[model samples]
Target: MGQLVRGVWTADADFPRDADGRFDRAASQFRDMHVEPVAGRYHLYVSLACPWAHRTLVARALLGLEHAIDVSIVEPVWQDNGWQFSDRYPDRLHGARYLWELYVRARADFTGRVTVPVLWDRERDTIVNNESAEILRLLHTAFAPLARTPRDLVPEPHRADIDAINARVYEAVNNGVYKCGFAGTQAAYDEAEAALFAALDELDATLAGRTWLVGDALTEADIRLFPTLVRFDAVYNIHFKCSRKRLVDYPNLLSHTVRMYRLPGVADTVDFDHIKRHYYLCHRSLNPRGIIPVTGQGAYLRLA
Candidate 1:
């Protein structure tokens, strides 16, 4: 949860909150940037545990952009120095031990939270875009010519519907869980928890008779929502105190999660061990003992 101030890493980082105790997530820096579609010119840095970063990973896989834009992964657990690169998952481009170093390298005085799903321009040696939503679109469009697959995640006809669904889901679901988990006051938690469940209830009903979120085929709307749903029962339900209902209780939503998991290359992007460890261990304030509760989540996610 640490952030950079004038390119210096501050140890005592606290999640920002409004006067009313509602968690206020700072916007990602490095927006309004562009990356060329040339193969091998771009690289992605991501954490498997992050839902936002996972969105880009799924897009990369679905579009068959693996051969074009390679990736470097940070260790699952975050530390005082923030996302670290261990011997197992070293930074391929630079030998930097921490992700913030990359941010500093990109801009000597960069001031903001150093988050992942960063699209690094290997040629320019700087970050092209750190926002996942923008990175997802880049993978879907800018890099489309280099993609081996013909899958259009954002179909032209379904653009409007997909955008509308993404807006609601992003606010009330994707970021809502964080608001619930990080809320500094009971009132804030109550408000966020209420919105999270309301959005889930609506989504469950939406998927009751439909296989996909928007069009006849899988779209970005489903991709954006899947990461949150996949992590809900295991992480958010308990870790975030969003225990009003487990994801499994919503039959349609659970079915949608399983269907997405069954997709080729999509399941491979999910590392349940990493996902569980990162949340349970990284957030020491939430679980001081760092004890990860066991659940039959793996059995639920399996295709068989």
Candidate 2:
């Protein structure tokens, strides 16, 4: 819940919330125009811990655009400064210490949530886009001509259908868990939980007969949902009190999660350590002591 206020980092700014105490996620800033699909001129900034950011990383790998677009992964922890680069994952573009610093560099008076999965335009010295869903679309299509991947995640006929799937999936399953976890009251939690599981039940049934969500092959819809599903059992199920049903409890979802993880390059992006530590340790509003649980990542791997 930290943000830059006129280029100054604030540890505790007024976290935007509605009157009902529901968490209000800020809209990503850089999403106006398209980034030119040129090789070696753009960079992707992401955190492996964040599902939203993770979505972009998975799409990058799936498209086989490793050489075309460069990526710099921030460390797994969130401190006084929002997402920071570890000594291991230094900021390659500017040698900046914190992610928010890059935001300020782009817009000197930037006053918003400094989020990740930012499509950075190194040539123009600013971000191209920060929204993950848009980034997924751009990654799938904008770079397709130069990409080596065989399949297209978003075909024309399936566009409307995929958008429809994302509408519900984003509300109930993807953002639903956050609504439940961040709910300020029992009523909000209850409502969120009901919707979350209902969506999961419907989706599990929908996926019961097939591997992909919309069509015969993997689409942007699958990329959008996989991050949340992969994190559910490990973090959300326990830490977020999404305990009504573990991801494993649903056979189809568990199968789908296992399959998605086993996909080429998807496994590498699922950083269990980062995912667990970021939620357990960083969200001090929920976890004051910052004690990370000693859960084994193998438990999830064995589910497949």
C-alpha lDDT values of all predictions: 0.92, 0.86
For candidate 1, the lDDT comes to 0.92
* Top candidate, metric TM-score: 1
For residues 1-304, could you state the per-residue lDDT of candidate 2 as single tens digits?
Answer: 5888999998773446578877567788889457677889888999999999999889888888888988998988887788998779999888889999888888999998889988889888998899989988888788877687846887888989999999999999888999888888788789889999999999999998898898898998988999999988888888888998888788888788878888898888888888998899877777789887776446766743
Give one digit per residue, the lDDT tens place, for model 1 in 32-139: 456678989999999999999999999999889999999999999999999999999999988889999999999999998889988999888899899999999889
Evaluate model 1: give its TM-score. Answer: 0.98
**Reference-based lDDT, residue 236, model 2:** 88
Q: Model 2, poorest ten-residue lDDT window?
A: 295-304
User: Model 2: how far is 201 from its true place, Å?
Assistant: 0.6
Q: Whole-model lDDT, candidate 2?
A: 0.86
Runs of candidate 2 exceeding 4 Å displacement? 13-15
CA shift of 233, model 2, Å:
0.7
Off by over 4 Å in 1: none
